[model samples]
Target chain A: MNQYTAQQWRRYTIRVGIYVALLLMTAIFLIPVYVVIVTAFKNPAEINLASTWQLPTELYWQSFSEVMAEFGPRFGNSVQLVIGATILSSIMGSMNGYVLSKWEIPGHKFLFPLMLFGMFIPYQAILIPLFEFMRDIDLYGGIPGLILIHVVYGLPITTLIFRNFYVDIPDEMLEAAAIDGAGFWKLYTDIVFPLSIPGFVVVIIWQFTQIWNEFLFAVTMTSNDAQPITVGLAQLAGGEAVKWNLPMAGAIVAALPPLIVYIVLGRYFIRGLLAGSIKG
Target chain B: MKNNRDRSIAFLMLLPSLILLGIFVYFFIGRAIQSSMTDWGENPAQPPLSETVEISYVGLDNYVRLMTSFTESSFRVSLVNTFFFTIFFVAGCIMVGLFLAILLDQRVAGEGIFRTIFLFPMALSFVVTGTIWRWMLQPRGGVNILPTLIGLDPIDFAWVNSQETWFQFLWQDVPRILTFVGIGILLIMAVRYALNQRWRSMGFVAAAAIVGLLVFMAGAWDYIWPALDVPAAEPTIAPKGFNVALLGVIIAAVWQMSGYTMAMFIAGIRGVAEELREAARVDGASELGVYRYIILPQLNPIILSAMIILGHISLKIFDLVFAMAGPDNAKTIVPGILVYTKGFRANAFASASAVAVIMLFFVAIIIIPYLWTQLRSDDD
Candidate 1:
């Protein structure tokens, strides 16, 4: 699309030049992806010395398969945490958002701040309290305990996003639903929830990546079979039973769910982040 | 429409998070307040499951121990080392990060390649970064080899010396701190540089190089290449409290995070209004002057936000220390690790909970101001 008169174009090639620069600029963002991918594919000898830029000529299956078999349970642990947290967070986040946005409840502003406090509080500050709470209830080192930890950390932003989005809907819609004798469940699942899918997706992606990659709670809440992959990945020391090739393969395999999400929803990730940050 | 249901619905909606946050975050903090009042680490003879637990109510005992005994131990020395570690680490990252971001922002030749080169740090998990950096920063690694290639003697940095102490003094047994503060300064500078794009375009490479030479010559690199990244101590049972090397751990953590902060700053800069820059120019201000007067003031919010986020990140750093300290090195102590140590290794569940609760309190104090601004700043 260099459609321009030569005389006119010569006078201002700056815009044309800038676009070319941008094409190259875009590649910078993509380089890490390339590096990680290439690292995952290369055989051991070729790993450090091979042109890190070039694609593999032959797909290395052993590393990939070995990592999978070794790390499959670890991933399962992580997935278990992610799945449990996602359902709880989305529902709780949605309900809180809808109620806050639609209702004129007492002390909403003050309560909002109290809720908002959760987002800014660092994970370190809560670990002890969470540890004690989990241990007290005898839920420590299990899926249920981990789910509570995940949801506790997750609520603030998810709640904030859904609240921000719900503000867009008409008060009349909520009022009319109530007038029509719709109860909370009927009103929510039917009226409010459907309208918030895009907002829901945004929260889902944020929560999903967070729980998927989260190491702190994963390491703390569980130690054995219940240990999440993030913990499992960190424990790779290449002992007698441990093969680094498998770990590398496992790391690659472990990285896929989010990596795939990044590839597919790359645009959405940026967009959703922009929406959150710009408003945030 | 009638709505007594509003309050109930609101409470119900808020129920799940409140219960969790209250139990885990708030109520558990109350528990920490209670636990910290007692001595959980003592009375080891009392079985873990004993109902009439013999833990004495040693009021402010841990705080006293934290200030005196714990701080006197290698772990506390490690904590102080973290303080020292953070200063330099934050500086190095900001310097290089701001430099790279601006260089990339200028739209230079092979900019994509360089930008990615800069960002390669972010994709890696801290565990991986720690591993790679260990290879690079180790005295025996390729880094010192570069110096030797240029006719310099091979520097035997303490980083590879398994028994080397980080600090040495002849004074009355003041605890010796072991931290990688020297490299920490460099890393912090790099991060600052990454966050500030204009600094990057200015590419005071000659200045940076001089600084690097000066720093390396000034014994900054000495502490960074510690004597014991691996274990020389016989692998034995994981000990109770205070074995961690906190200083070295915090430094490695700061190195890993500073680059990420740069990306955030870039995002912040993009958020600034371009029209204001044009207006400043129209007012006959020089580019740098315009930036000094207009750009920096606009960037205050982002800078504050970055500091807050970084502070929080710093407090919870476990990955870098864990990787660097190895199994037998008693230097990777933080509340997070302490909790893991207590619950999983020692099976002292109540004590671990207390540590988690205490750490959470510390986190809240740092986070509150930032949260206040975050919630209200949008309206402004």
Candidate 2:
């Protein structure tokens, strides 16, 4: 009885230790979020070095109003860009994945790896040529062009995630549809497409977050009129005589859409994240 | 007849993507390679953006200059900075991730909440992360002032603007250092192969190691790649090393990405069969021993995958550094920023493409092997 009590006590101590460690880590991870929130809420007059960590005296609505005014157009641009790009890329990825995984496409063994390689190359390697090509085609500076860039570049990973997702779907299901005189299009629509809602969710979340948060293409591919929220936030934070509150507000505003998606559908988000890297 | 038609339909469906990817990924890469070997922006006669400009082929002149030119010290520094950043960022993510995974694996309360807090940052843009961290790491405010709340002097460390460097090395010695590092890796590989009793592979690795050692001893690096030699006029010995300013950027990067690794590890830890762990515990293993001996070994592949993913991300890191330390801050410059500033700002297209090509080479070095192994495993 004494030995058992000692073991229980030790286990209790270990559990307590784990919680403490976890809480400490949690605090560290959330520090920036805390700072960003507090800074965003603090009035410009109250924002300074000495009172950095202090809670705001009162809620300040001015920063958000000002940031919204400045970033309103860019925010719309990001939405349009993300939505257009996400839908196009996800549809294409699903079809490609369906064909590659379910159909008997020749050279798929070689093609899959070739496509996978595209996602990993530093986009910098192709940036110059892409810039020139965009210019030559008169698609250099608009939301549509940016959408195209995102969709094309996004194909590899979206296709990858969907392919991995589709491989799990039994081939017998497809064979049955084929035997029912369902041609390729009918089979996909009847059997595969309906079953891919979960895959679509994963791909959509991944692409939305990626295209929304993307800075390089947004900054480079778009002109001033088509700049995304990322560019606006960058300029807001990057100015010489910036009020911290405004940029902090901008950061929060820019981060919210994806944050909401992540918080709500986090399981699918993680599935997308893991699928992009780890093989199924 | 139906199968042939179906195959044709499949081919037709794949055609557009194949064409797009071919142009955007492969064909454009070829174009960038060609652009990098030109004098488009270097020569006075060929303005980079001119409608009717001449672009003469320079045959690796841009690469040679980037590697050795006195004016291009920034490129070399950026290269070294990326190397250090990748090492620390990858290692930090794995350690933090593994720890968090272990802690959460203990059936902790509110695991979902803790996980959400940890991972929410991953959803934010690097630009957002950079902006927030830039504020938090302000020299006079933010994190620096946190100590004051606890009754200490406000810490005054310059997070993003520090000019201090660590582990300094002369530019002239880079070749020797690379050679030595290569030899070290080969030696390690040889040992691992020996342990596995793979004599033929071990013999090949040993041969490579011996050749690397001979090259190092003979000091043939400069003679073989003469561009690495410092130019005579700038003989003051350009020094390159890890800049302290990048510490803040690396910290922010790790903060954002460690969650990803944690997720990977948690999945890996959960995948470990309960029976294996129970058996280990029954054999008198401590909880720590079960993790250190059993769980961690099974997580090796997750760790490798995480490392490769994070490594490539770090290698091409641009936006975070750009947002935290603006494009012109030489102290925190990276190749991605250099490409941006050079091509976009300075119109130095040739040099920009050269830097970009170098970045691609480094990424390819890490990614190709990973993809090969990963895809091959899928085939099996």
Candidate 3:
């Protein structure tokens, strides 16, 4: 009886230990969020070295207004960019994935790997030529041009996720459809497309977050007028900033769209992330 | 005829993406390689951005200069920074991720809320992460002042702007250091092969290690790669290694990405059959033993996948450093920033492309093998 009681006590200790460690890690992870929130709410006068850990005396919401006023146009640009890029890439990826996984087009064995390789290369490797090519085609320095770049670069991962997603739909389902007089387009539109809502959700969220957060291309490819929120936030936060409250506010503003998507559709977002790396 | 027509339609549907990817990925890479071998900006007569610039080819000179020249020491420093950053960032993410996954696997309550808090950072932009961390890691303020709540003095470590370096080594001795590293890897491989009783593979690895050791001992690297020789214009030695300022950026990166690995590892852990674990437990294995021996072994592939993903991301890191340290901060400059500053700021197109190609080479070294194996395994 004493031995059993001792074992129970040991197990209880371990369980408590696990919770303590988890809570400590949780606190560590949330530190930046805490800092960002408190600092964003504080008046500029209250934001200093010594008082950083202290709560604000009262809520100061002026920084958000100022940041919103300055960042209004860039926020619109990011929305337009993400919407256009996400829709185009998701549809194209669905089509390409359906064709590659279902139809088995010739040279797909070669072509699939070739396309997948595009996603892994550093964009820096192709940035110079892309800039020149964009200029040559008269598409540089605008939201539309940025949209095209995102869509093209986005094809590899979007297609990869969708392809891996589609692989589980059972080839027999497509084969049965084909026997029932479903042509390529007919099969995709009637069967595959109807069943692809989950895939679409995953791809859209992933691409939306990626295109929205991207900075290097946005900074390089866009002119001042077409800058996204990320580049705008960088500019606002960059330099010897006299003010800290504004950038913190701007970061919260910029991070909201993707954060919302992730919170709402977190399961699918994780699916997209895992699909990009681990094979089905 | 219907089948053939359906095949044609399928091919046609994919044709547009194929063309776009061809131009955007393959053809542009070729163009970058071609431009890297040119004197577009190097020559005074051939300006980089001019519409009708006269271009002349200067094969590999830009690469040679980047590798050896004293004036281009920043490029070397950036490369070293990338090396150390990739190592720590990848290691930090994997360790933190495995820890979180192991904790969450314990059937804890409120797992969803804890997970959401841990992973919310992944949704935010690196620019946002960089901005927030910059404030949080302020020399006197955010994290430094936390200890004061417990009656301790405020910490004063310079987070983003530290100029201190660690593990410093001379640039001139890089070849020798690399050779020794290569031999070390080979020797380790030989030991593994020998343990498996694969004598042929062991012999090959052992021979390679011996050859590497001999080459290092004989000091023949300068002859093999003339770029290792010190240039005549600047005879002074330059030191390069890990910079202290990058720790803040690395910490921020790990914070944002560790959740990603956690998600991957959770999936991997759940995929491990409950019966296997139960059997191990029934055999009188402790919980730690089950994890150390049974579970961790099954997670090897997931760990590799995470490392590859994190490794490539670290190799091309730009925005976080750019936001935290600014582009002009020499202590935290990476090759990605160098490409931007050189091409966009200095109009040194050839040199920028050269640095970019080198970055591509490093990424390709890690990515190609992983992709090959992944695709090959999928074929089964």
Instruction: Return whichever of 1 and 2 wins on TM-score.
Output: 2
Q: Evaluate candidate 2 and give its CAPRI docking class based on DockQ.
A: medium
* Candidate 1 residue-wise lDDT, B86-172, digit = tens: 455566566545544544555457754554444444434555544433434444533445456567876555452234334433211
TM-score of B-chain for each predicted structure, in order: 0.67, 0.93, 0.94
Q: How well is each residue in B1-380 modelled by candidate 2, as lDDT tens digits?
A: 14778878988998899999999999999999999999988888767798998989999889888877778978888988898999999999999998888888988889999999888889999999999999888899888888788889988789889978889877676788788889899899999999999999999999998987887788787665556545553334335788899999999999999999999999999999999999999999998999999999999998889989999999999999989999988888899999999998899999999999999999999899999899999976
Better of 1 and 3 by TM-score: 3
Please write out the lDDT profile of model 2 over residues A134-230, one tens digit for every residue.
Answer: 9999999999999999999999999898888889899888888788778889888888889899999999999999999999988888899999999
Can you give the DockQ of every candidate in the order shown?
0.30, 0.78, 0.79
Docking class of 1: acceptable
lDDT of 1 by residue, A128-238 (tens): 556656778899989888987788777877888888888888878877888888776777788888998888887887678668877767776785889877676667632
Rank the candidate models, highest TM-score first: 3, 2, 1
Is candidate 1 or 3 superior in DockQ? 3
Q: What C-alpha lDDT do the candidate models reach, one value each?
A: 0.59, 0.90, 0.91
TM-score of candidate 1 chain A against the true chain A:
0.84
- Candidate 3 C-alpha lDDT tens digits along B1-380: 14999999989989999999999999999999999999878888767798899888989999988887767878888989998999999999999999999999999999998888888888989999999999888898888888899999988789888878888877666787888888889999999999999999999999989987887788788765556445543323335778899999999999999999999999999999999999999999999999999999999999999999999999999999998889999889899999999998998988999999999999999999999999999989
